[model samples]
Target: MIKTLDSVSNHEHRQIIEKTGYKVETLRIWKTGILKHSISNPSNEQLETFAMNVDAVLEKSNLHIDSKNEIRANCTSHFLNERRRTSKQGKETKENIKVVNNIKKKIRDNNLTVVKADKGSCMVILDRNLYINKVEEFMNENGFVKLDNNPTSRLINKVKNFRVSKEFEDKFGKYKNLIPSNPKIPKLYGLPKLHMDNIPIRPIVSLINTPVYKISKFLSDKLKDLTEFKPTYSIKNSGQLAESLKNLQIRRVLN
Candidate 1:
């Protein structure tokens, strides 16, 4: 059998060698075509060890092969593109953090309270009484005329009377009946409601009625120095800011 195997060409011997199980000695014998004097069938223990080694080699090879296949399927440029995308995201996150920190610092420097609301919007609240006092001081300094008291009730009465008057009837025409006889006026709890030169001045705590795009644009303008920062305000943030400001007022009232 050894002589016949030796007589065969190398290609024939290789073909025979490929068909055998993963026994190292068997392959060597078939490949070399040399029969060692002590040649014998592998022991069961030897076979098991050889099989385990072969499986280990195959598993390692398969891992490398799968990686190569993935690279080929996605194109060779995939790794580079993935790295660049991750780097860009990291840089953007860092820039956003820096901008937010800067805004917080600015607020602190101005001795104002800034609270982050939902959807990336923030609220700036000032002491209402202090702010009103400042406005009064400024008006007094400028020799501006001021009303004796708040005109909230007076304005409500005026609006109510106008709704039932001939002017409202002439303007609204058929819609006159649709107007409520006793319309409820929105109550201003902690807001400053003063009159200057007979013009009613009311402080707004909520910007909920303002457009999100406008708010974003406003924030962008305010924080323009932070070139990498882009503002994006949602309507939800506006409502949250209003609610927070109201809570602040309620806290003050309770205190």
Candidate 2:
């Protein structure tokens, strides 16, 4: 895989790829699945740890709840952080440029897709009819209803307010709909690299209403993983940036 990615192009071939369906910022190499851990059933030790953590948090806050109170939310946050940490420390999974070129070659050779090279990037005009059929079947099986208006038509604007009003209450917290939040489990956001890049650089997941809400929630959850360090504890000399900012404000008020 490494050799294949290496052989594609150093720089010149990037333009070739842009002409294909994958334009700049849309192309990404595939990475390992990010949400695999949370979906699987937890082990005994994992369950015990989760229970203990929830108990500790609740005890401090004077909150009490039964075991069925959906602690999965908290556990999912912790597990995703673990995965992100592992990914940052792990090796790069992206095949070099050559791998992409090779994929293009294979698609064209088999007549599976038509590839075109443009100055900016390569374009691969996939069979839209085939994809539409597949999507129709998937939507039918998934219990989704079609909208009365065409998604791209001016008629969409007529009912656009309905979408805005409803999607917020349904997806995010009250009055906090527009924020870009991280997902708890990474989904196939229907962008380029069908299965690649857990986080696309500039994701189009926002274009689709359901995925926009999901991705935003995940982003919000991911932000909580920032570490809080303390200074003058005698063990660690450094404080976290957030803590330092707070300390500076205190000193200014005191002075």
| Best of the candidates, lDDT | 1
Residue 238 lDDT, candidate 1, scale 0-100: 75
Model 2: per-residue lDDT, tens digit, 183-216?
2222322222321222111122233343245444
TM-score of decoy 1: 0.23
lDDT of 1 by residue, 118-176 (tens): 21121213333444564465556757675798665675455335534577458535432
Which candidate's TM-score is highest? 1
lDDT of 1 at 115: 23
CA lDDT, every prediction? 0.42, 0.42
TM-score for candidate 2, residues paired by index: 0.21
* Residue 129, model 1, lDDT: 44
Which regions of candidate 1 deviate over 4 angstroms? Answer: 1-87, 109-138, 164-255
Pairs of residues clashing in candidate 1: none
